[model samples]
Target: MNAPRKLWLWHVPLILLSAIMLLPLWWMVVAAFDPMHALIGGHLTLWPVTWNLKNFVAAWRSQPFGRYYVNSIATTIGIVTLQILTSSLAAYALAFLTFRGKRIIWGMTLLAMMIPVQAIFIPDYLILSQLNWINTYQALILPFAASAFGIFWLHQAFRNVPRALVEAMMMDGASPLTILWQLILPNTRPAVITLAVLNTVFHYGYLFWPLLVTNTAAYRVLPLGLSYFVAQQSGFMQWNLMMAAVLMTVLPMMVLFALAQRYLRAGVMHYGIRG
Candidate 1:
């Protein structure tokens, strides 16, 4: 076959995967509009028999989702900011500095990355409880302040930075911190951006810890509030309202994903260009 035909064939799997990914979102939009009666057949659909805003109204009024939104956004910002700071500093040290126990520290970081998050939940909870941070923003934000994966990812990215450039900066009187902030990070834009995006999505969607700590709506995040919203309906619950709530929580992430994709697409770099 021709080059065009071969390229078209290569696009087939991607198109199929995209559709698979979109199917649930399509169903969600449909369910968010349809009446409760119509959704009881246990069949998934993209077509809405109704288009009333009742579900949205009910979902919003059913809980303090407004507060949940605030909590989610604040905690997400805090976690991402701290992760970037801690991960970058640790990664920078691991990449460039000659410190005592460097190899041991690197080994521990790798081990931390390899450990499952669930395994640490108990100890993490105990630490936060001892500090009396349960149900507070600190409970939500503090545990995720450092990410082993972020450190490892940035360490590898930092390693890929041209050594000659770092040496030149050093010779020109650049301090380690200065070199990290100015030279290292700028050149590794994609890696940093990817880490930020991943952390944002993960922390923003975090539910288990919020559920474990927060008992009141005052400190509730979106996911935890969503669970309460679902539980509010006793028997044959309003899936439409639940779908509405879910989509409401997901809308922020969808917007973020859209924004992030634009930058991701423009992330291609030439050899001499800063990413």
Candidate 2:
């Protein structure tokens, strides 16, 4: 078959656009390893003048990165786990169950998605205070355990399951719970993984709520720890150290995306199945 001539033109602009989007990320990687002099001089080198692991080592030692790392991992996992459970359950019920006010409830849930997080911050802080959960993991993890986007995305994926299959399960004496676990979940792996990736990354950078809720250093996550690093230092920013700190903070998510990029892309498609 002859190639479509216009296809090449379509991709030419897309390639250029992709390069433009990637330039900042490329700069960040280069800047992270540049020598202090090169960094100060603002030279854009494709490769570092001298390669050293000192930035990473210094970043790790400059603060309690070990503890912060552990806390961040734990908190992110906790939130993602709860989100999967709650969002899946809510999505299953919304997608398959017939009940009074189902549409109304679904509408409300979708409406909740439109509300800004900033609007709820005061109420969330007040509730945490009333519960005396300040400086506790509960304060950090509980409120965000269920994401509107996750529920909405999973609901869409669940909607793609054939209605005939659900009817067959019902005729076979399988309850909704059984159908959900055996029928829906097995087919929605991509959507689940995509939501998990998004939820994990979202939690990774979660800062404002943590800063307001956590009063002590021991509970600090990477974002808060980086803030503390900035505050503890004096004079003009130590460009090298700050870049090193930024690299340390961003490394885990980068490693995860690198390892799971294929799965993440598949999941994104699944999540968008209905859309």
Candidate 3:
């Protein structure tokens, strides 16, 4: 009926939704430190009754998580870096350059985005197998280096850049690469950082492709490692240990988001306003 009441009505729903979403994360933190017998006995609480660090130690020692962490970090960084580079270049060309069949190319990119990766898995696997790239970093990283969504996102951001600025740079006899590196990239900093953050977050948790590609624990990434850890718990589920592994697997991405939140927010704002 009143403004404050209406505001409360909206805020109440959102607050409830937020709590619902965060419940699992809270459960994870609680379970990660709580003793296994307490967890199994339904003694779970919002706070840890008895804090134990053994779960973390056991989870870490149980598997080659150290190697898994290294592989995940390397593959994620490689994929994000290459995706940003290739996507930005393609976006710039599509947004700024005038060429024959440009529309067709753009259309194709959109079409590619429409097709899910699962649809092309067989072909991709065969190709990688032919190249003898399975069970290697190349298998993990190369297939995902080019992102259709990244190209589309950056294309929208690139379009927001003024044509006059590009023309002025060209008038100064700057090469296309120079113009892209200096003018376009600097102006699109927020978008670039946001894309990087998003890519990092997505690839950090990527499980399906890595599972399909690699067989051995040598090249196993975090997600696969977590799954393997779960599988090793044959008779009884080690809830506390599993939760510890999850927290460990998730911590880096959480830190990454915290560090990049500013840029990510700015980028979202920029895209929203520009659109």
**lDDT tens per residue, model 2, 1-275:** 98886777888889999999988677666656766633355555666667676776776788998889888998999999999999999999999888999989899888989897778899899989999999888988999888787789989889889989998999999988899999999988778888888778889998887899997888999999999988877876665666677888898999988977898888866555553
Report the lDDT of model 3 for residue 153: 90
Most accurate candidate by lDDT: 3
Model 3 alpha-carbon miss at residue 67, Å: 0.7
RMSD (CA, Å), each prediction: 3.9, 2.9, 2.4
Better of 2 and 3 by TM-score: 3
Give candidate 3's error at residue 204 in angstroms.
1.0
Model 1 residue 6 lDDT? 62
For each candidate, what is the lDDT? 0.84, 0.84, 0.90
Per-residue CA lDDT of model 1 for 1-275, tens digit only, reads: 54664676877899999999999888888889887534468664568877888888988888888999999999999999999999999999999878899999999998888887678788888888899988898888888898888898888789999999998999999998999989999998877887788778888898888888778889999988888887878887777888899999999999998989755554423211332
Ranking by lDDT, best first?
3, 1, 2
RMSD of 1: 3.9
Clashes of 2: 0
Ranking by TM-score: 3, 1, 2
Tens-digit per-residue lDDT, 1-275, candidate 3: 54564565788889999999999999998889987533466554788778888889989999999999999999999999999999999998898889999999999998988998888999999999999999999999998899888899999988879999999989999988999999999999999998888788888898999999999999999999999998988987878899999999999988988899999899888775543
Regarding lDDT, does 2 or 3 come out ahead? 3
